[model samples]
Target: MFRTVTRVELSELDMPRADLAEALKCCLKKVRKGHYIIKSNCPNSHVDTIRHLLREPGITFPTFRGDIRDDAEKLRMSIATRRDSLLPEDAFSHMSAALLHGLDPVEVGTERVEVTRPAYSRAYSDLLFYARDLAEDDVDHTLGYPVTTLDRTLADIALDHPLEVSVPLISEGLRERHINRESLLPRLAPGRRGRKRALLALELASELHESGAEAYCAVKFHRHGITGMTPQVTAYSSTGAFIGRNDFRHEKALVVVEVHGVGKYYMHPDGPNAAARQNHQRNMNLVNAGFKVFNLTFGDLFRPKIFEQIKWAITQALEHENH
Candidate 1:
């Protein structure tokens, strides 16, 4: 039993105070007496009343403001149903690193947020990428929220993601053993992946070590010109305890080559002294077994005098063998 008491002025009325009751009445009358058109603009001001009066089943709530919250249901419904516009973060979840580097070849279209959540965490979203049980260091920020780091990303790609995407970044970072090893090594896993990569890196690092001793050792070895004997030699104690794997041991040639790189191991107060004593003990054991051992430093290897010392030692070994 609703009726309009009197027509109210719709002129110069501010939103907060403008005749709410009368406006509601007039809107109702229009719906019943004339073709009711809910104005497309200023939807929120009129939406509540329209919904209350109409109460139509299955009709959607009218669209209003442009914000995601304002039309969240409709937008979500449209996205699920339309199939044209994908969420931004979903479209580009794994490519954030490449995108940050300005290196992504393909174009991504949406602006939705991407998130990486730990498996143990209960938190989730419709568009989030759930990363199962990520390590503490792997958690980092992408578009303000946490994502994986470059190393983690590469490792993920190395293990599970495609090789075409992973190889370029991994090879570039690891080609020079000294360049980014500290940053990259932590991300490698322990089994086959670790051992295989470690061996390759070790070979390069070992070469780099020798290059520091004498630049020509690498060049000579690679050139294959100065070859008397190669580096695989075995050392034995009278009781056979297996002291260490030697770099080079000449059979019946008393010369044992120890190559010194530029940077030594991390030094404490007695670090160098302790290292020297250990080397002396090891050399003593070798010498006691009737072998002459020679150590080479970076400077000594490069020096002509040291080269003569080596050659002289070789000649003596042959002379001793002859005796």
Candidate 2:
């Protein structure tokens, strides 16, 4: 999340203290809200002075305050600052639109504000222009800033990035019901520069994926020629009792792969120890029901050695079944 600071425009300043005003004028960095700047680099004396002023009554700050670590929020602030500079017909597109629409960009950076213009394409220090005309249906302003529609944004990103980078966003759009697969297909039609990769991404995309991590894991599985896995599969006991829904299931090998963050157990409402106990019980149930469960963390998915082990495990299971 990116931090937002309360700003009083330099032109609107009515300072009773000359020293404070002088310090602010000298050290304040320019942001859309005015001369409000982060205090990270300011001298301790200046920071103290600014802190005192901020404490004064009737000096309310905007909702966004302090350090911002959220990428989406940071991009939003970037868009807000640059909104005034955009032409009336221009709208934020591609990755910028993706972020605005609440879709993750995966491996892409959010530093540059991508805008689509009716005229020429160009790149600037902190801005990128996609030269293309947008239909009335392709633009939206519900976010308080002009941006490409959800379908348009996904298509644009799909057309510009690789499968690994684009599939997660597409899957998220589908998962969230913001855009359907059919509406986005046309934009990635044949003869487009990245149509092949884009189409593959669309084919691999699944709304059943609960998170971008699962969608990405699907892509990785495909790339590794492991195509038998299905997302969000339910396991059942021989007597038809319900077992939990697993993240990915390979029926032929009787393997269930679960992708999750380490914090899941720790952050559960029931507490980490209880969560771990529940997880262990579930794993035992799946095993007893003739399923091999593999718990994978986000970090595990990225390690080649881990994938190699998974492949070997699945292969062994398949061979055993054959015998």
Candidate 3:
């Protein structure tokens, strides 16, 4: 969202008049002197006089040096005339707005801007505006400028980005555990007419399990008639701090299961390796204190080998529980 100048105030310091003019003049040269301090193309000399006129309407800078006030009215007036330009997208600037809005998934580079145009549009050949066709629902507004909502942003990313790129972003949200799922739902265009694949993509995106991995494991678990196992369940510490809610929890046994994804081995900037390592140390401490830990990777989660392994582990834990 964009912010507008909601209010203004004036203050005075015991600084000398020449030094004050020099400082204010620098502010004027850098940005507009009004309500919003936007970048300006004004000279230093004229800026000081404008600052003086702001303090007192009839005051001239060379003649009126006593307790001069900055001009609030003229500053506000300069920006008020350019109200239409005060959009959030304006802050993003050029192709940056497109990536920020989710019209496209762009590489997060320092200076390279990325944008997308309509499928039929002519290519501009500008290195900055790397264009692509927009899905109808992807185009929307934030504070009256074009941008995509969070859901659409993620969906677009899923469709366009590789697992190495996408997983890190998703893992960051999950590891921090502060993803705003409710607000993100609106941006998902669920049906065929709109962003048809987005809802499914979102569900897939949240899955920590590799594709088809959990399904394979679940089938074997069900076939064995594992009475105590629950899939897609929540987990908590003894303190009930809700640490890493899991894929499965055997309530009777107090054991948590996680179905790890493929990227677990990859070293991304926000890779699961670091998070998993930290979790492993904590989980070891829990096990040392007589808690149960059950983890399965993409290799294990999808394999028949994992079912036998888990069956063994559960049997051993159940024996300990009886003791």
Candidate 4:
């Protein structure tokens, strides 16, 4: 979710660099280089002046605030800009709506904005418009722009994208409590295209998964027939002392699988060295408790060879437990 900064509309003016800077100096506050913020209370005359200046070249007033460096924020700005330029009847849908509703971007690219309008389907420039009738419950204006509700957006994603792309998003929505399966399943009825894939994704969706990567990892485990694993399992010693909460655990096999991101250590609040030390200590504790730890990276999870290694690890751990 985006932090609500000062609500300001951004205008990408077409004028000489120096002239544009001078023109906006009086009515707008220059927030970033080449970007200005038009305050909500700006005089109507100043607004008229901006409108007149852009009579020849059209202007899109995208309302966004914060660091433009963030990719998610950039995508939000893109969605806003596209929405501002579109007809009032059009509403953001599919992946674009999912982003607005705070679902992980996942496999969806930010290059094109997805929209829906009655009796209209076309790809123009950076907008992919769908032709579909939206029910009243499907549309929302909570963000000050027309966007599909969370359930509707998930349904659209399930219909349009594969499980690899859609599962993470659906899982996220469930985890966030933004939408429920009971609400979303009806949208993917019997006659709908991609219903099977959507149903499978919904079946796999779980609120217990912490991140999109973990959710995707669950899908991978399901596909590879890696069974008997539970998510977010807490590990304990034979004496009933807590060791740590694991990403995944198989009790019978006495195995714990941890999915590590590239910046897991570096992005910690404490220094990376401290984070690494803590992780090392945790691993030692888990090992001392007779739990075989299998640490998997994002890259490792994507490659099939790593799963073979994991299978071997699981088998070895199971044999050890039996012995």
Candidate 5:
């Protein structure tokens, strides 16, 4: 926990903006009207500001000290803003380019820092720089200076990463109403390096995928001539009772492609998990009704060989269903 020393005054100057201004300009962040917080790396700055702000009336200047490890969770937003203060320019755009645009935070991820137009410092491991001018609609006061628009963010990620790797973020952004093609397609027209990548990503983009693994497997199935797969499909038993929903299903082939994450997401050995139990019962019912189930994971989708296995499963199921 970060240790803090508090002092209340009567001046009503609140955050003592001028004193903090003279302190570390980087760490001064507005939490709300008449209030501010600090996350300065420079202890002297904090000490000096606290001392100065304490001299004023109606002010509550709290000086925080010690390690911030335990308080990191509560300080997440502060840490993000502090990180933002480190970049050269257009810091927020870098964030949106790689991570924002309503990307699935649980699966794909979010970025800490994005260096803009980073041609010189190409050696840093933790830093990612994008070399491009901000397109129209890329920045806003609410989004902060130099953050990519939803469309531009997807285009940028698509440009930097492989289609399979980047699809989840973009697809989720699309699915979640975070972005669309009208704004994104225009931005793709200007860049040569990412034109093809962005185009392909957009072409393959679907609101159906909840994870990158699902998107990757969907595309591979398409390439493998298993075009009948419908994503996020629901299935029922032969008696017309509700069973469960499948990730990707082909009704004509009587095949269901299951993206395997429920084991980690819902399964619990020590406690009763309704989702897990229901999924198990539903799968058994589907099997009894003659539906062939195909399973894959995030890792399995990475291997090229999984496509052939999927092809075999789909082909065999189609033949059996027709017979």
Candidate 6:
């Protein structure tokens, strides 16, 4: 394939002298000082430059993907590289590699730098280095050129992380529609370390359990006998007008159950009550429009008192159902 070549010419280009020189270097060989022809398999950077110069007002060239990455592709690859250092050669079949490939805000914070290798030393209390070989292909990349894959990521996390940690991550993936049980199951080789747990986690996962809190609330709500509540629900009026979306809603009782935390609710830097004011207004609008809105806080959901609050909210919505 490298035998056949594409020919291009260069002259007084609409660029600086240094740029003109660089353009000349993009060619396979200079036909003369002012003209040149480039090989089809020329480095992408060179080919891209030639393509750009030739592809002006009337000039057209067939688009071909070359060894050089476009600016956007370069950016993606750069990020992917920084995220994971394992090259294609290493047998990086390990969980740390998986984490590096799929590290998000939930798994590790933005500033957290992971150095995954088969070494362990407690340098910093915040930093952790797992003592395991990074098996090649143990993970897939977040970007196209990345080493680890998401399926590998799920399996590894499921195997290595605690149930509390892994379930939330898997739940978020399922709830956000980025992953599915069927796709992940096939990726798990028989006798894989985390296959059983991963399969169980996927089976119990639902798109409605958006957050760890939400996922926990779902199970607890059911245990508390709170039926008919749909998670991450959108409510609409009888006339099809848009009512605000509820974290959980029961259509039969016209009840909207929502959880609140400092992060989920947006607040202006100017004042403490800014988010409260906006939220209150929306809740009041729903109430006036004939929906019983129950605002549940983290405390309300996690504590023993959650049962009473659930009963009260359901009773209120049910009693006002006739209205």
Better of 1 and 5 by TM-score: 5
lDDT of 5 by residue, 1-323 (tens): 12222223213435464665554365454542333454444455444535554444443332443422223223333324333344444444433334433344323333234545434434243344555565445654453345566666666667766665467667777777656777777767764676887787787778887665687776676566667788888888778887777888885788888887645344555444665676677779889877877667656765668777767777887777678
| Candidates, ranked, TM-score | 2, 4, 5, 6, 1, 3
Each candidate: how many clashes? 3, 5, 4, 0, 11, 14
The best candidate by TM-score is: 2
lDDT of 6 by residue, 1-323 (tens): 01112232233333444654564565343432232343334454534534554434533222334522132222222233233334344323223343334432122221222334556523333234445455555544434433445565665566655454456566766766477877777666688776776665565556767566666566566557777777777876768877677888875777777888556665556455777777888788788778767787766665757666766778776877666
- lDDT digits (tens) for residues 15-110 of candidate 1: 233434544544422322212232222234533433343344433333344432233323223222212223223221233433332222111222
Clashes of 5: 11
Q: For candidate 4, lDDT tens digit of each residue in 13-110?
A: 33344544554665454433333444333344435535443333333333443422255545555565454555777789988888777676546744
Model 6: lDDT of residue 273? 76
TM of each candidate vs. truth: 0.32, 0.79, 0.32, 0.73, 0.62, 0.48
Better of 1 and 5 by lDDT: 5
Clashing pairs in 4: none
Instruction: Give the TM-score (vs. native) of candidate 4.
Output: 0.73
lDDT of 5: 0.58
| Model 3 TM-score relative to the real fold | 0.32
Model 3 regions more than 4 Å off: 1-211, 264-269, 285-289, 302-305
Worst 10 residues of 3 by lDDT: 60-69
- Angstrom error of the Cα, residue 186, model 2: value is 1.8
lDDT of 5 at 40: 42
| Model 4 residue 45 lDDT score | 49
Give Cα-based local distance difference scores for all models: 0.42, 0.74, 0.44, 0.72, 0.58, 0.53
lDDT of 2 by residue, 90-166 (tens): 99998888877767654555477899999999987768898887999999989777999999988888888777668
Return the candidate ranking by lDDT, descending. Answer: 2, 4, 5, 6, 3, 1
Q: What's the residue-level lDDT of 42 in candidate 5? A: 44
For TM-score, candidate 2 versus 5, the one ahead is 2
